[model samples]
Target: MHEMLGNQYFLIRNYFEAEKEFEVGLLSDPDNFKIKKKLIVCYIQTGHVDSALTLFHNIVSTDPKIITDTNPEEDNCPCPEIIYELESILNNSEVELKTLSLAMLWLYCDLEESIWYFEQYYQFNKSTHIIKSILASLNKEINK
Candidate 1:
């Protein structure tokens, strides 16, 4: 089934394929926690942090330990390399970089760093409320 195929691709670090497979599997088994976990990593790895975080919030609502469940060694979820690749460019003062970096850091569960980037982003683009909303929601989760 798609879940098995997704797991195989996940283990191989082919996150794009894994994401596709997991998404399909999820369409059939929407409550599959394992698939959701792997898909979250795949989403963040593939620069789909919005999707990842959406699913993350969904799961974390019921399974409060999902963050701890996503360890690379224990769960085979790799650290999203895009975050590293993006780090090298953070010195640039581009709004998109700040937004992308914010999303990446947030997905990595680096809330402190994500907040830092969010601050940087807010300075450049204060008009958008979506990013603020995301940070607020994350703050609520952490505060609770």
Candidate 2:
């Protein structure tokens, strides 16, 4: 009910009130991806790119497979829009989106991002050999 009200407010361009309602919904349902997605959308709609990115990272990190087989309904799946918007912001170019699309050919589509994360991990602990090995395998797969 609260989510629906928030979504309604969002559709009517009342972002501030929508955010309040969504926040309240989140208070009750911390694990509700649906409400989280709505909140993120409200942020984006309000030009809160940083907030949206934070939410995007949270969602991506926690749920690597944002689009699973169980949720076939469009209303339940905000992943497509989330991915599209993030790709636009992250890449901001036709060429870059093309590159990202190619990179997502195999694996979980966020594998490219994982590679970036692994590089950061390597920087912190150069002696950890597993990260490098997995990176090499992923690189080989990406290149092929």
Candidate 3:
């Protein structure tokens, strides 16, 4: 019910309303990846990049497979508008590198762009060995 309403609101570009509905749905089914992905799109559309990035990190940390798994039959890309918005955010000087890296990864940005973002993030915050491994793995995956 909430998911349907959220989808309707999303279709109409009422992202705030969609966010509310998706949030409600998430509370009930916290493990629903589809709902979580929808909510991330809503957050991105509504200019809540920080929130979206946080949720993105959570989702990736819980199930790294989500980053690698792709379903050819489904349109799994984030909405084009949201992708544009995230690109704008990434181009800005003040955005957080970690957030930018995760956003680019989630949006399935070009491999070069993803590598750049990840490199920038690593240069800024070198303490996270996990990010380095993830970057290495992403490079290996993309090369294949």
- Reference-based TM-score of each model: 0.66, 0.46, 0.65
Which stretch of 10 consecutive residues in model 2 shows the poorest summed lDDT?
A: 99-108
TM-score of 2: 0.46
User: Candidate 2, residues 35-141: lDDT per residue as tens digits?
Assistant: 66567656755656456545544654565354122242444333344456555565455443333222222123346664665565466567855546655755654
Evaluate all candidate structures by whole-model CA lDDT and list the values in order: 0.68, 0.55, 0.65
Whole-model alpha-carbon lDDT for candidate 3: 0.65
- Quick one: RMSD of model 2? 8.3
Who wins the TM-score comparison? 1
Clashing pairs in 3: none
User: Quick one: ranking by TM-score, best first?
Assistant: 1, 3, 2
Backbone clash total for model 1 is 0
Task: Give the runs in model 1 whose Cα sits over 4 Å from its true position.
Answer: 47-50, 53-65, 91-109, 122-129
Ranking 2 against 3 by lDDT, winner? 3
What would the per-residue lDDT of candidate 1 be over residues 89-127, giving only the tens digit for each residue? 756765474464445345454656656666666677688
